[model samples]
Target: MYQVLARKYRPRNFNELVGQNHVSRALTSALERGRLHHAYLFTGTRGVGKTTIARILAKCLNCETGVTSTPCEVCATCKAVNEGRFIDLIEIDAASRTKVEDTRELLDNVPYAPTQGRFKVYLIDEVHMLSTHSFNALLKTLEEPPEHVKFLFATTDPQKLPITVISRCLQFTLRPLVVDEITEHLSNILNKEEIKADQDAIWQIAESAQGSLRDALSLTDQAIAYGQGAIQHQDVKDMLGLIDRTIIYDLILAIHQNQKARVSELLMQFRQQALDVSLVLDQLISTLHELALLQYLPELSLKYSAEINNKIMQLSQLISAQDLQLYYQVACKGRADLQLAVTQEQGFEMCVLRLLAFRPLQPNEILVSQTQVANQPIQPAQQPIAQQVQSIPQVDEVQAISPEPETVSAAVDHLDDEYYDDDPFNEPSAVQAIEDEQSSDDFLEQELESTVEPVQVVQAMVEATPVQPESNADQIVFDPSSDDALFGMDEELAATSPEQEAEKYNSDDFLFDEIAPLAEPALSEQTKIPVQEVKQPEVTESVATPPQDSLFDLSSVPAVDAVETSTVSTMPQEMIDTALMPQDILKLQPQVLEGVWTVDKWEFWFRNSELSPAVQELAQQGVMTGQINAESIFNIPKRYEALLTQLQHALEQALKSEWPNTHFQVNYAEVETTTPYTMQNERKAKAFQRASDLLHNEAAVKDLMQNFDGEIQNIQLK
Candidate 1:
């Protein structure tokens, strides 16, 4: 005996229908103008007034007081139609009668007059379910029905209906209701029913309906029963298994503040309550959207409670706008990754950790501005290790540090300097040098006992012998110059002979038949080449020492069979070491070439130069434009400008090593002339073409083509 709320509150007339004003107005207008279509079709989703409108139209046609859109409920015909008992109103569920025979049978009564009303109404509900043959059988009758008969069709899916059947009918489509429309309708229904309900609870039910009035009323009926009398917000939330709004808001705030522990605690509560974690991420994303709206557009309303609005405003200010966008994207991505995670709880925890991990920088970790960096003083870059090792102190600086005490070696050197105009290496002078060394030694011993401290003697030794002898025996050079016979000879020893000198120092060491460095030798007739006093360049103490990458630069060293080492007592170890080195290494890095440089020479040099692959490619791509003021000018395409700039310094160094005087200058420009790369490619292509033509003209190839019908499949140059 209990009628459900959906059925009890169903709209009966055109005026009573909710959220279908278009259909109602059209039908009302047709009735007022007396221009009603005989075949009527209503189409929409479930619970959107499709069947309801069709039934209302049926009542308007059957009403007693001349047919009208608003039929009087007091009439027996209207009452019978409302109660589903009108004889003339034949309602057919097309889903049940889909056979052509059933359609033909249904069309059997179309010619007859109305038994109880002015028109015979055939209402087919879910008409799309009818078979093709059934639709074909009904199409003719539906198009031209008798004067007193009307065909009414209603289907949720109008696309399934035959276009022929649809063409004969006047179709009206119904639209689903929005949340606000459903909510307002429900409130009015509840008010008329005199059932108390919370607005939030009603809103929850309306939102749950998803724009269907039937579902909204059905939920309202269930809620009324569940609440025993009055619907409450908490009861609705519990019924729907929704998390508390305040809890959701608090969880979001905890994540924003980087409160990991608090977030974990709240997540544990969610786990204990068995709430949907995915739904929580959805809510978080939604809340972030609202927060962004509040941040960028502060004037926009959130349509929430005052407390919720205040919380949103505070959070918008607390988190940076950039961070808000990052958090939103991270939340959305986490939601998608949830299904792939091993467990839902682990996935949710990881997502929360990400939100806390990618927060804005703290005060101490802020980046320094360019202005601050510019204000700080710049420090020089550290020299390479090899360069640092080569930086030896000058001889003057060594003398300044500790004043040189003239000892045996300094006395011998002074003797050479004083006797430069005469025979410096004569036997007498050598003997005199030995006698002076002996006298200096005796004086040093007497002073060592009285005034010369051991520390001062050690300092004198260090200062006197500035250059240490190399440990390698092969590094010693034979210089037939100074008193080689004076040093390390006792008083009882005799002077050396020229034959002994020649035997002691190898004859091959005297390569040039000219005067050599240091004091010239005045020995036997065998030593005819007088040693020339070559004045070496004076190196100032202020000049910085250049770096030497290696101890032995074989590029500058000449090929030599051997050099015999002989004791040169008077020669300073530094001068001996310099003389021992090859002529090229002894000289500083040469700056100027001996002759003019040519492009062909440069090309040959480039072909042989050892360069990296990228650097080599750069050289091949560049075209030598001209030589300007001893500089080789090259132009590379502007497209390769960046590459050229990067490899310019290295390529220039390679070029300079071959042509020292010619500077390599490269510019980025449109290279119109042929480069090495283009020339090489052209040469290769021409060679390939010539080879191919020679192969094609061969007799063996012609025989194979004429006899065996063979064709050349491919040609490749190896």
Candidate 2:
């Protein structure tokens, strides 16, 4: 029967153990010095020579000729121990003998002297599986064992061992073999077995082992068998489910070039070959990481394989370092997400798609040419002035007018002498400064000019400009103070003016009264309005100033104003009261409110309670106050004020149609939490009483119970 390569080429001695020099040296020195501890713990990951070292230590301690670091295998003690027949040397698998009784029975014999060898050795493998009780029973004996008995413990999970047990034993940790070490070891094994293997094949096997010598040997064994005694790169690659490195490089290049079709073709090829999608992604991520490293640190770039090195160099040149980092992050995240994907192929495809989506487009030369062309102003066949105004919104018309200030000022100056020369406009001396301001203003106007229809801007501009009444334009407008005719006509006016004034007053009053009743009642006297009084000189006389019908052209006053007025009247009462009627109601039209509160803000406020809910709630809760000074009226906490401000703005937009020019500031007033003196005293007394009761019922009782667990049950406290 031909034995498998893993078993045939197993390390038989300390010198043969791979990748654990520190552990080997310590065990060897301990044997040579005759300073061996009774218990030794070998801890490491699988395939790192944990069990191999344990057996070697057993052989060293039990060698018949002498306890030598290099045990003579021909000796009776060495051969028996190696062949597992030595009476004094016992090897126990803790994984199997994990019961407390097993440990107790085994340790019961520990006190006896060795039957044949200098020291009796117990090799326990996978010792972490021992039960708590078993560890407890072994702990005492392990701490202080007889001189002739030796204990060697091996475990992959040292963390599971009781700290007490760990403390009692001497520990040696075996490190994983590096790729070079594993490759060299595989090479020597292949030579010993007379198997021909490529250096790259050996290296691939070594890397696939991930720093485990046993695993590396096992993989090499499989490769040799697969190749019928001679290992090659293709055989190893097939066995490990690895995609060809060249194909991987080509795939990465395709991704870098953003060749979506080529990338998809490669993925299909991989699928046809039944390649592990996750592993392929893993390798890709690893390759990208290596490339990123090369881009940053040229010195560390020497270790990769020739193909990988070449690919890294090419990638480093093709992609910017920042883009490379981004691709690396995307690949890494894709690798993680792949695990959760329904299928590895789907995950891999998604990762590829993500890379494609995020990859920056190469600068198109054609785009630059087109941009240059677009930059050259193409004059329209018709004049754009009328089209520009029509394109801009009425509100933005103000900003549009700002840019032409100098030109308008110049126009105004020309008009000043010809029309009204009392005020001469100053010209801005710096044309560049004017142009800079004009550019910014034009940018804003362009947005409006493109979005707004020309008719609206014209209509708005006409509406916004104040025009003198045509009748008053020719009349000598008397100063109100100089016009005594107005005062003498008061009695005559009362007879004629009562009905018109009453009707006008009733209309205005009815509009305000309609919304006021829906508002939250005014808060208590403590919450006062912070109103500042402005005293204006009284109009001493009434002048026949102007007629509405004669002012400019009454025909062009716009039906929009009536529509706006009706809209404002129809708004929700709460919104009208809170946002439209407070102050500046004349200026805040529905369109202005719409612009101020974008669609997002409107939706946000509509979902929340109507404006002034807090104040209303406070009034209902009986916490209202009427003191209106700034500190007293607006001292509410920032949290409440923010909530109120948001609500107020939303209300403004909602009710702008009803009250076009309303302005209100949300004021938060802080209220002091006052505790009554009687309540405070009562609380203090209760706290003291509770403390006294706790001392007597809990602390004192605990002390008494602690002192008397039945030893002094009859004793009574004074």
Candidate 3:
């Protein structure tokens, strides 16, 4: 009878072992040095040489050449072990005989001398499956077995075994073989068996085995029988139900080129095949991630086939890094949410739509400005300025007028008084001292005069003029005595009337000349201004004004009334009292409160609660989307996936503390419909709008604005 490939291809000696050179090397050294332990435990996942290595070690211990790493297979003892007829070597299936009586019986025979082989060998498979009583019975013998006997134990789960029993045995952990190693081994086996196999088929079997050599061999046997002798890529793909690489390549190409119909057709083709949509998406995500990585590290040697390499190279150049990242993220999120959908195809379709939605705009997709936008009638929501003010509160005209200032003081220093002065009547002297500062470049001046019209130059100068203070009587019209202090003037200069100001202005014509460029006015013939015919003040030659800046010294103030209002109160009476109204205080209680856990409330408590860094991050990224009975559904963005693994338990424990007997089901979502951060922002925006509307329509505010010509530049509510 033809034996199965898994059994037929099983390694007979250390040299035949496909992978795990570490295990082989250590065992060989131990056997060569004659330092063998009383009992050996081989631990690993299923089909990874746990029992095979034990059997090989059994033969090594019992060979006719004496205890050696290289067993002489031609001897009767080695032949018996290979043929499963060794009298001295007892192989037990611990899983089936997991009883105290069975272990006692086995230990009862442990002291016996070997009938044929040099030393008796006991090989127990699946040793962890033994009952607690059986373990207890075997513990003493496992720790101190007869010198003539060699005990070899193999188990898939060393963790399940009691530490007391594990401590007595020499343990070797066998690592799972990688795909390349498994594939190469299978290829060699096929060559030895003279079976024709394709590389793709062998690779598929290796991947499907998930690092179990026995499983790979078994899958290879199935593939050989299914193919009737020869293995092909198509047959393997059909058998495994894995979507073809061409399909992935075609789908990505369609997406990158923005061919919506082609993408749809590719997906339909996949759906017709009835392959797992989740796996397809996983492949897409993986491909996109690899493509993005390749953009930076082009020489990265990944395990993709040659047919895929060209597609990756082409798509890497076609899709930008940002687009690749977005596509990958969406694919990952879609795969995670695939189970929540009614059908796999629907979920995949939505994911594809999302990807298409964010696709870089094509030439035709770019919007062009049109004449219709200029001619289109404005909607009421996009009203003109007149209609905007129609809803505003109307201001009553003011009848009150304040007395004009007697002298120039600290207030009007910021005011420009040349030609387009705020007063409109305060033109000063056109002194000859100012005329000397004019430029002598007659040619350049003439060219400028011809190119720039005098009217345009005047308008430009007006535009460039320094901003003047809001010149109203509610604002102090005259500079305060503070200007006198700033100039370090005695009481003599502080009380000068307007006529002295005119004379002082006549004296300061050179100062005005420095600012002529800002006004650029046509010079007047008269050097002195016609002042109001009051008594000409006697010059106080005793105390000379410090300099021209002394008369205009308002440097201490940033605004006209900035210093005056430095200590002013913040808000109006009604607003202050309303804001000062005390909020209801909350007391910490031992028991959980019975209130609706809206996003607002959840965030309020979370804000006040002290939490660990990990749990707080999880809470911030996630939201309590729904609470169905005791189960609370929390969702985070897909990128914050670590929240589900490392921090999930801690986060759930924290939620239980707050709710006191609740469960949390956490999920990752693209967008949160309601979250504390969004809720707070909405409330703040609403509050600002209300405050702005109140300021605009308040009757008292309108009256003040009309009387004082005040403009409300900004209104903020906190």
Candidate 4:
């Protein structure tokens, strides 16, 4: 009979044990110093050398070399213990002898002396399986064992052990083996066995072990047998049903580049090969992690072939840090949600599609572009001129109007004279000043011509001109009397006849409104217009005239009478009143009241309710079964029991604000009735089918199908 590799390659002593130097050192020191405790306990996960170390300790205690850490196996005591035939070293499986009677029976022989060795050793494996009563019965004896007796307890779960029992024993916790340690151990075992194995194959076995040396050895044995004496990388991959790393790298690169067709092709290949999508997703997630690490920490080293490492470096540079993190999170979430998908392949494909769909926007992909605004055709004059001006090309129109810089200044002067002089209400003196301002036009022309760009000339021309185009060009024009026409003078001043105004020119009572409006325009244009002062005629009454320095003194002139009728008001009085209405007093549209919560109205409420997405999912999968007292009971599928409590609380919180008087209870059971989610899906399906029929009946669709032999593979509703 042949022994398995895991048992055959088991360590025989402390020195031979791997990945547990701390435990071995402590036990060795205790034995050498003669400070060994009466009771010892070992704790760790399975296949991590808990029971193995216990057996070795028992051998060290009963060896013929007088309790040495390194036992001489040739001695009768060490050989019998190694062969499991030592009379003094007892090995008991606690799982099989967990009753109090068995524990008491075992303790009855504790006082007896050793039959063949200097000390009696008892090793109990899986000691946590013992009943509570059994532990109580053995605790007093274990705490006060005879000088010649030793108790060694080994358990995978130390948490189940009583604190008192654990306090009395010397506990040693073992650590799980890492990949490198397991790989090295497996390599040494294969070398001793004279088995030829590829490095990649050994690495695969070690990784599959997930930090357990025993599992690694067992996988190695399977690989050897599956490969028929020689372990190969391809054989290992086939046996483990793992996709090739290069394929995974290609898939990642395609997704990062948003190659939808390439991703679909890879998914098709995965389907044909029957590869495990869950494993593919795990590998993809691991690769994404490596990419992120390389981006943030370029100096860090990764465990991959040189070619694969180069690919990682290339991908790190190609993908942004944010996009890489997003891909990683999506992949991890997809792996978790694989069970919820209709199929594993579909889940994996959607995960890759999500990565492609959510890439960062490029420089040119701004949400709103100035080009679109500039290209918009201007609306008619019915629209505000200010709004129309925004869509007009800025520099193009200015440059187009005056290609030559020499005429730019003259064109500006001509525009000014035409705009202001053409108005029927202009003052004679101001128009005369415009005519006189041409003397300095040559100097302005020199400045405008020297400018390099037409845009600068346009800017200078705008600054030189005063009185911008009026926004209210459509309003009614006022009557004569320079001050009254330009400054909106009071009607009383405009109503006075010229003969009466001349008679009252020397009047003592001069209204400030009349004098102030005349002074403001002169004050604003004092430098631009040169006016000579004129003295008034002699009068008996004291006349109120403008100040001595006042430009274009107008007190000598009398007020003119009003024109009986002014230009018609372009805006009607009704329109003005409506425009000036206060916003606070405006009528508000009434909102529809909520209807009663009944079985027929459940779908309507669910669709329109303001609930969180998580709570909505819970509500969608449920139907209102009945109402008990003030509490409404709902039944969801039993499969959602895992999420019942959390979703239940969210549903209640969302409903309490709307239906505060009624309580909600969610129960998990077999759903026999139709759910709101099912009804919604059915309605969507019907709508889609109706749309498809309408589309197919159209003349264009029929012509397209007949002319090109095209088929409708899918219908999408926006």
Candidate 5:
């Protein structure tokens, strides 16, 4: 007869229990001191000595040694209890007969006297599965059980048990065994059985058990049988389908070294083997955590094999602690979101590549002591900021990078010089002028924020530079005092007529250096008044006359409605062929506001937004819920929440800036609903349809398409 290792090595006494010393000690002292409870409850995870402890306690109560903690194995009562034949001790599986009728029938004979032992014991395993009515029926007898009887209840999930039923019993929580504890116990068992087994194989079984000794022993039994009474690491790995630790070590090493090729190769191997990717991520996360632990506490002993510890040590030394922490977090998030991915392999590969993407920059992370010393600011020997900025080129690289010479746009270049170096406090006129321009730094920041290339600053400057009309035999001069047209003409085509100026600025190379910038026209018109004259260059008969060209002349751009063969003379031939959004500057007007809640109103609000990204996103996804005197309420999605305190303060300031004395608040909306984004999308769709119809129906477009074999891929409107 083959006795399985699990049953063969089942602990028989209190001291023999593997991991639950606290429960054992408490029960042992209670029995030794003649103190006993009517009922006892044992609870923990599966195979963690819960039911086994219950049976052992039953034997101790019925043993011929007169109810002692250490049962006499030789006695008939103890032997019968051990072998499941004890008349006074009853072991029940509550999971099967969980009905109230069964519970009532079982409790009907509770008052009966013990037939053989000094005290009768009732052991019920998996008691949590009992029905609600069954618990109510058993609760009375459990609370007021006969003095001669002992009740022993065991369950893996104590939370499922009724509080009324659990409170009546002496609860003892059994802890899951650590890996090292299970490993040592299995080694002792294997030694007694005289079975040859590798230490690593035994550790593998222990690790796989996940803190359950019975499961570990059961796995060891299966391993021994599979290995023909001999356990080896290779055989165990083959049976469990666990990825080899060496592969994990190599993978992590490759990742830390940023070996993309090796990482891809290893992932291919995993895919070919049909390995579990989620499990691999879990292991990677665990290994990263261990490496992080070893970084700070290098001398600390870990409960793993020497090979695994060596791998951890190597990784700790190889990867920085910050990088390890980052890898661990990414791995954890990947594992949690693994099910959301379209494929497990995609999720796993992304997790691995993400680690590479966020690898710590060693050069930037660690600062030299000399650099730190150099960064210390000098207080007493501090020089004027202007002198420091101009004379000391080596003082700051940032200072040297700025102050670049003028390029195409004199307006932007002059503004940068005034912004970066000039003292705005000393020059009140310049201060007012800068304040009126709304700070050129702000516009530069907005453009630069969305740009990646450093040369874009110069490119944007070139695009904004104004062009002067080419010098001819005649020159036009305007009076500075009067608000009239060019040369003091007071018609609608006067200097004050923006429409006439716009048309001339586009058609003719008129000087706009004295005029206001269109982006912020109000202040530019009021404060930036300048009278100018153009000096015509004398023509030479020997020299050839050159055609005039102006960079970024926005006024000359033709309208979309005017995209016909007739307007081709004034507009460029290329623009007609590649024309896109061409909204007329003459017809363009600021959107009318309803000053109340509606879809159109929301569109207006979103169009005129000045909110931070976090709150702006909230506003875009939310609908206006309510409004008080000065405060506006918005319903935001619960899943997408803002830091309410920070958002409240920001929105308060923004609202006051836009509409004085106004305040705002946002809260998590209860119901899911459509938002302002939906309206914006609807608007975009209609506009797109209009553009597509106009392009496909146009006569010039159809002729071009027929002649050039060209097709419109997309259409956009400004």
Candidate 6:
């Protein structure tokens, strides 16, 4: 039978063990000084010689040639222990035999004397898997063992073992073999095997092992076999599922040039070969990191094989350091997210695309040095003095393309002038005042003419009337200055009266009278004359106008009540049909009005208007409300302006300014209400209170003691 390389080359003794000098030195010194502890613990990662060291320590204690530090392999006791036939040297697999009964029976004979060698040795492998009860049973023996017995414990996870057990033992942590160490060891092993292997192949296998000597040796053996007894770089690469370093260089170069097709081709080749997607991403990230390191520190030492070093050097020169750092971050994130993708191919494709998208553009071939002219800030420098006479017109091109600040400022000023000219209310106040006076005079003249004939007839009647008739006429005439006369008229008609005209007359004497102020009598007397006869024909003609042609009777128009309507139209359709429809519909809506009637007639009556009580109250409340609502409506737009404003302010203050403006838009909905209860806090408080009470309760203390059976020496926070 052909013996496998792993078993044929297993270490025979402490001298044969590879890359564990610290552990060997410590154990050898302890044996030399005769100060050996009762128990020894070996801890390390996988394939790092934990079990080997444990076995070596056991053999050192139970050697047949009378307890020497180095076991004499020629003796019968050494041969028996090596062949697993020694009665005193027991090798126990703690992982498989973890029951309390097994541990108890094994340790029951620990107090007895050794039958053969100077000491009986117990070696336990993967001791972390032992049960709590088993650890308790072994703890006593581990803490205080017989003088002739020794215990050796090996584990990967020392944390799982009780602190009491670990504290009693002499713990030794085995370290992983470094790349150089593993490589040197592999080279010697390959030479001993007489396999023709490349130096680069050995280095590749060592790096792929990640720090395990056994793993490196195993990979080296496979590489030698895969290459038909002559290991090569390509054989190791294929065995490890690693992409070629040249291929990575090609991909990175393509990315630097922003060449999409080349990048796609490389990714397709990777897919065709069925390489591991995550591993490819990891390789790309590593390459980028190396490039970054090279750019930042050109003389930094690298551990890559010589076959990869040349490619890395060329890549570092091709891409900029900043860009390499950026892509390195992207590649790292892509590698992490690759596993979450639906398929490895999809993840791999996306990662490649992401790299292509973020890669920097190549610099132009025709490089030029920019120079500052006259210390007036660099203005492209007109292609420099040396290149001004070039045939390419580069100097003229720079001067022609450069924009001056004076020209830009002139253009901006022209735009500002145009904006101001477009404003309808930008006319001077003097001009506006003159226009207003002309319009008011024209209106007053029309009104005076319409009432002239009636006034003349009424004055003639007042003069021709007798004394008793005059007294009655005086009572009917109106001076138009008395508050009582104005108040007595219909409110609708009274509001239409020219209060501006009344302000022209003095009312000091009219207000001092007690018997229905004289202004009332004067206003009544002016109105009592027989003027209806003179205006009968005009009134009949005016009344004959069609309803559609005539404006609504201002005197008869009723005030709008605050009743809800299914369809509300504010301004009359006639006004809308005649006025120019604004280009921006949003700006056409009336923003403010004087009275409730005007507001109802304009903004509040739109059919689709969102007129809630909250919005209406916000609009009508006061100066502060108007300012707050206006800002709220503009900043945090919503139909329910009041509630939305409050919510937005609260959220903004809670999150500081991190809250987004889009989150407070009108289309975004408001939360109706929030309940005031949190289950986590309540449950935590209840649990803490229960624990506190249990600590003080005599009954609970008694119950714990009864159930555990062991004495409660102390209850610690840990």
**What are the per-residue Cα lDDT tens digits for candidate 4 across 1-718?**
9889989988989999999999999999999999999999999988889888988988888887788899998998888877889998788999999999999999999999999998898999999999999999988998899999999999988999999899999999999998889989988988999999988889888888887788888889899999999999999999999888889889888876667899889889998998888888999998888888887899987666678678878888877676778888888988998999998888888887887787544322222334454455545544443454454544323222323434533444443342344533232331121222232223333223323233333334433434223222112222222322333322433555656545443343333223323322232131323122222234443212223342222222232122111211244644322222121112122324244334445655665778777777777788764442256677778888888776677667766777676678767787787877776665555545544554564343553585458788666654
What do the candidate models score in CA lDDT, each in turn? 0.66, 0.61, 0.65, 0.68, 0.66, 0.59
Residue pair clashes in candidate 5: 484-495, 485-494, 485-495
Which lDDT value does model 2 have at 613? 53
Candidate 1 lDDT at 319 equals 67
Worst 10 residues of 1 by lDDT: 485-494
Please report the TM-score between candidate 6 and the true structure. 0.52
Worst-scoring 10-residue span by lDDT in model 2: 471-480
Best by lDDT: 4
User: What 10-residue stretch in candidate 3 is worst by lDDT?
Assistant: 394-403
lDDT of 1 at 488: 14
Predicted candidate 6 versus true structure: per-residue lDDT over 449-487, tens digit per residue: 223222223323333433221122112222222223323
Q: How far is candidate 6 from the true structure (C-alpha RMSD, Å)?
A: 30.6
Segments of candidate 1 deviating more than 4 angstroms: 285-305, 312-328, 334-380, 383-718
Model 2 scores a TM of: 0.54
Clashes of 6: 13
Give the TM-score comparing model 1 with the true structure, all chains together. Answer: 0.50
lDDT measured at residue 415 in model 3 versus the true structure, 0 to 100: 37
The lDDT-based order of candidates, best leading, equals 4, 5, 1, 3, 2, 6
Write model 5 residue lDDT over 222-323, tens digit each, in one string.
999899999999999989988887798899888877688998899899999998888888878778877888888888887667887787787788776656
Write the residue-wise lDDT of candidate 3 on 656-707 in tens digits.
Answer: 8767658677667775466656655555555455445445543435534754
* TM-score per model over all chains: 0.50, 0.54, 0.55, 0.54, 0.54, 0.52
